[model samples]
Target: MAPHHPEDVGMTAAEQPRQGGKGPRRAVAARDRTRQPTEVRRRLIVDAAVPLIAERGYKSVGVRDVAAAAGVSVGTVTYHFDSVQEVLSEAMVLHIEQYYAALSEAAEHATSGAEALRLLVDALFTEDTDRHWRMWFDFWHAGEQSTDETFARGQADRYTAWHRQIRALAERGVADGEFSGDDLDGFTARFAALADGLALQRLRQAPPLTTQQARHHLNRLIERELVPRSPA
Candidate 1:
């Protein structure tokens, strides 16, 4: 059996007018309905593409496959995104925004630097078996081969934004006396790098380390490295 598309599910084809004078009115209505579905269809395409890219790697998935998975035509996908690179780029941006939004909220509610760090760690590991890490690896692999300048710039911007946030958090820790006033830049870089490294390790290895182990190790490392000593 042929796969079904969204339009095929319930949208009826626009009917021809009985009189020539009425044709223009029907045409306008049809056009409006068609445009209305475009936005909904585009979101569906991105949602479908996420899991496909995560499982098959972005390089392996093609535009046609995304359309099929999204239950839309190839033309529909292209109408919303000029190319697969554009789709993947937008998807990456959406993922990063959603992840950071949650982090931002947690930070606002956190009572201390340690509390913020704990929330961050919990947010990272509390997801569905590190699905974000898998999607991130896929994005990185795709970004390496992409020739699109916009995509490259967006990728750099994401990393820069993340690093900036990490630096700000470290600075706050120092100001609050939870962390030593030692090299903020170094501390932020190391802290961010450790999370990325652990994510990679978990993605590549089987029998993944439990979330508790990750939290315990990270908390201990933060205490030993970042915490300030009391004044004599």
Candidate 2:
């Protein structure tokens, strides 16, 4: 057979081999794809740990338990996170990010300030009741002694984001002839406090308040403040 030139072998101009060249670059790309599963497994481990730490508190949970919850090996969990503290820190960041993202989405879709407030309150309280509340309490306890900057920063960011959203909604209500509050800051602070208090109440009380009761109470509070009243 005649000798085949690089071009005759279907190599493109860019694919032409240089002097002393190594093998194809595609091999490196393929290797990266293979490693992606490890990255995905790491994320799974973190996701699994969020609920576990939320339910059991971070100190009570161990690396092996997270690995087991994630259905991965302990080495895999450690490969992604150095320790339980690291895992919990990362998990808190992820949870806060996701929680805020949902709130943002809800606000974007809401038709009015009242609707936005409703969505915000619902997001704060809506969950699988027992499991969600348990996890939240766990996180509270875990965070008490946590000196992790990332965890603290994430929490502060969440609070700031929430305040901004509530303030924006209050402003929108004023602009749309809905709300007549004199102090946006005071109202927003009160609203947030009410929601947090309600969440804790439901979390601690046996046979926790039904979703309807929770919604009714929140809606009434929001309506009284944000809804337009009929002229007498």
Candidate 3:
């Protein structure tokens, strides 16, 4: 998979739609891989930068490093991006967008609330996703020293947006009668926190939870806490 390509947790790439499209369709421009559009080339560069920055913090990667990774010249990198920081920042945003896009796609086709929750857990706990969590850990730590309000606020907004996403999903569960709870705000807060804590533990702590173990733990939490309401 390309660096920016989100994992196919519950859906294949063919099944995934481009933004705002009803379904996946063949793109005329995409047919010619040899001659990529400027936007596509820029995305390729950002994609290459993501895992590198995720593995070795933003300060460590230079324009030449990104250009080398992207299989492009340093001049190409400069042409597409203003600086190394711009490249890294754009890569971070692209990484997060891919993440949200994956979850959104999975949730769209989910048969039930339980299935949706399971899909999310599967997406989050994969071996490949470990890098994603580590990336966030690095991003959060860097934000601590950042004096740029715009940058810090942008990071903060993503967290708030994620919380809202979880809350919306929990509300859907309640509405579908799959989960028996009126305190959806509390449910969202708790579950989101649980996932975050688990991610950090899996990344940093000794004797880390294997992906399977982590998935089972999350599933159990949903099954126990979000009890099904029996039909009348």
- Candidate-wise lDDT, in order: 0.72, 0.69, 0.77
- The TM-score of candidate 1 is 0.77
Q: Candidate 3 regions off by >4 Å?
A: 1-41, 71-82
Poorest 10 consecutive residues by lDDT, candidate 2:
4-13
Best candidate, lDDT? 3
Comparing 1 and 3 on lDDT, the stronger one: 3
TM-score of each: 0.77, 0.71, 0.74
For candidate 2, give the lDDT: 0.69
Candidate 1 on 35-92: residue-level lDDT in tens?
4466676777788887777677767888988877876668778768888877766766
Candidate 2 residues lying further than 4 Å off, grouped into runs, are 1-33, 37-41, 127-130, 206-208, 227-232
* Candidate 3 structure, TM-score to reference: 0.74
Give the true-structure RMSD of model 3: 13.2
Number of the candidate with higher lDDT, 2 or 3? 3
lDDT tens readout by residue for model 3, 104-150:
78987998766787888899888899888888777777678878787
